[model samples]
Target: MSEKSTVPGQFTLVLHSHLPWLAHHGRWPVGEEWLYQSWAATYLPVAKVLRNLAAEGRSHLLSLGITPVLAAQLDDPHCLSGMHHWLGNWKLRADEASMAGNTALGAHEHRLATEALDDFETRWRHGSSPVWRELIDAEAIELLGGPLAHPFQPLLDERLRTYQLHEGLADAQHRVGHTPAGIWAPECGFTPGMEKNYDAAGISHFMCDGPALRGDTSLGRPVWDSDTVVFGRDLHVSYRVWSPKSGYPGQPYYRDFHHYDHASGLKPARVTGKTVAGPDKAPYDPELAAAAIERDVADFVATVRERLFSESERIGRPALVVAAFDTELFGHWWHEGPQWLDQVLRALPEAGVTVGTLADARDRGYVGERVELADSSWGSGKDWRVWAGDQVADLVDLNTDIVRLALDTLDKMRADQDGLRDPVADQLLRETILTISSDWAFMVSKDSAAGYARDRAHEHAHAVREIASAISGGQLAKAQRLAAGWAAADGLFPALDARRLGPALGGNDESGGGSLRNHAGPRGRRMDAEGPR
Candidate 1:
């Protein structure tokens, strides 16, 4: 522990990184652009920070939740090549900005773009698995896995939900050469008895929002009599650094995320004030931002120390404070976010506050008493409404039909001894997963890129319906053609073997804290028995 004699608890930083399947989809403003920007800005810089600390012997610095969907993009050859090109284009755009007389902003952009390009060419040219694997191998970070696509588990069919989780874990193993012991449940969404599924898949721990535990989130609790521990994110600490209304990122000094310079495609302004318009915002200065990062880092460290000490006293035991957020929040949304994160990681340990991964905190005996958590998520209202409410009822109905159709089609095919190895069946499953991604419902509810998100969901759903219809009607040619077309356009998860979906139906017990009899399915590695309660 890096804690001082006076510091009485632990702090774990958990970041959930995810993006929907964007490869070969649209580019600028929506699809691959989102992936490329996060890679160059967030992933590369954050990896460098961790690698630097790891070299200096910092262990378990944080828990990084890279959902399988994002991992697939990071390791995809097509995406890697595209990202390389994007970086080169970035540097060129910076040069263009310099030629246009915005010397200061251009020079900054040029330097950032050049360094990112150099970093990408030298190390990331091989893909990101190796970079992340280095951190994991060095024990500098614990990688958390999630479903194949980041589907809202609570709303998904139990059979498909288990399939997504198992396959997602397997995908992580295949890419990074290690199995994750924990997961960031998509949206931190969990239904009662879901822990049994986690137990069945050999997952040891997972995260939920603090409110889900009724605000008593000082320690990890065993859920539903299962040994799979669930840690709740401490919003008190998390919101101090970044939240909807208040946070360091919203400070006047940081670069404005929404105000863009359309000509050069750069953010040239600072967040002058909350009500400031894009055109009226002041110019950004690195020096101003650097000073703010220092101040913010010190403030955050003090806040964490105070919280940890108070919680330790109240709980009568060493408490654990888990602050979790979306990885994209750093760099992508707030340009100075990655720098602040680097400083925060360094400052906390120096300030006598223990900084470690969730696994480290748990292993140090931060476990709490068992509790039956209510059905909940970290979304608005701390419930499933964001994903399954009236606002997105169409998406909800579409997902329900997609799940039923796929299962019925698969069951019929298997009844005639046609197993899941068929290409049509594999592609059908892929479409189903794409349609149910939590991102769609989130986008619709927030009205941020809602049209694109809705269209994407419907497109995948239509594909599933068409493919399943072809399979059920015995139109093998039509089914294969439709599946092949989809495989060409929206294909992700190269390791997504449809056979891992298990016994399509009747597998979920649904009545108690027990999972399907066969969880790993054919062609999948069998999971170990659950830990004792």
Candidate 2:
């Protein structure tokens, strides 16, 4: 009997692409560089992979969640232009190395640099590629939407959160030319009552980690709360491709993530093993890594085929095995991830293991009804500890205090008719929303770029406090001073409306001192627990 005859089901893949709104915010360690690097390593390459697969007449299923913030950067004329310049600069830097180094090393450096430049230019040429469009059109990809800036849903000022979510959806529709059927919920952060807001906004489904589904680490069905389906990531299958320490990319033969050449500030080494560190690392060999990709892809395909058959037989239906991961993991961290992706897509069809997107699987009746959902995330241990850990304890406190102060200020401004048109109020609202951006806490927790994280968190906090003090003390002169500074900062959520937050804070008082606990239901109740996802 054929393997297809033995296996009873299909599998789905969902990839979420999210980065905080970093344009014009911070640049060096954590801000724009993060976006640019991901764009080069993961976004552009993955888009190319999808386009290539579709061209070969392979209709594989993949769900991609591109946050509104990231979309803005991608579509921004300045970012596009800057990206082009950056790639060109990279080529120049590589050339400089080629001229300075020994013949063999110089030649290798020159070749790799040329390849990088060629790939980037070819894919991003003319400021357009139907790569994203082609996948959407072919129905091979499903788009997941999120807020304008990825603020933590439960921690945000309720009205601002609603506006961010609504506007984010609208923005995505405008940019991509389609309203998404689901949302990626920032970091898959979901609260008990957020569903009502999602429902009002016309979102039909969303995704969360497996732990969110009754604490079980398996593929789960949709939750209660208004028929909006929830698809949980199947970590078991996902971890095989990328685990904390045991992922395929960590193999000694892969390109090293750390240990760049200090003088040139370029990566020139391969991961020898867990013990290899810094200056002692061996040279990278793309050729050797390519060989590893074939082996890993074969192993991955067999795992999926086996999973599909096992799940199908167990469930007595075509069960789906969803493998989800951060888009940055590919090409950026793994280096060989894109190659592995290409091989796996081709291998699945040959093995008769049908690959499909989340939407396709749902349409094929692969959904189940579950009422209870646990509070969870895809962070360490699949929980919220990372964002709320001791390392960022001060940030958590700062966010709480600032949010409270901003809410109070907004409430005061609304209560006084004179404050309605006051530029200070408007500025306060802007600072408040920006301050609550989920990226700050995330960066602090990860320590990936902690210095920038501290600066950003403190900067927003300073704005919030200064504005609040000015408005409260009737120091119009000083408030204006602070407002000028905020304007110079130039945050993205400038048009945030404090009135939208009114209902959430207990009444229409815009001074900002209302309890969200009072507003925790459909109308106002939906406003109670807005925090970062």
The numbered model that scores best in lDDT is: 1
Task: Encode model 1's per-residue lDDT on 140-225: one tens digit a residue.
Answer: 99999988899888656677888999999999999899999999999998878789999999999999999989988899999988
**TM-score between candidate 2 and the true structure:** 0.86
- Tens-digit lDDT track of model 2 for 1-533: 38554655677778878776677776666577777777877887788788878777767457888887777667666677777776666666666666667344446656645665676677565433245666788866788888877877754556677877887877766766778888888778766667777878887778888767743323446566576777778777888998776889888788888776656556777898788676787777778888899899989888888877776677666777888888889888888888888788888877787777777776777777665665556766555556566666677667767877876676666777653566677678777666667777787777777777778778877888978888899887999888877766543444444555444445665435422232222211123236332
Colliding pairs, model 1: none
List the global CA lDDT of all models. 0.86, 0.71
Residue 80 accuracy (lDDT) in model 2 = 74
RMSD of each: 6.0, 4.8
Model 2 Cα shift for residue 126 (angstroms): 7.7
Clashes per candidate, residues 3 or more apart or on different chains: 0, 32
Summing lDDT over every window of 10 consecutive residues in candidate 2, give the lowest-scoring window.
Answer: 519-528
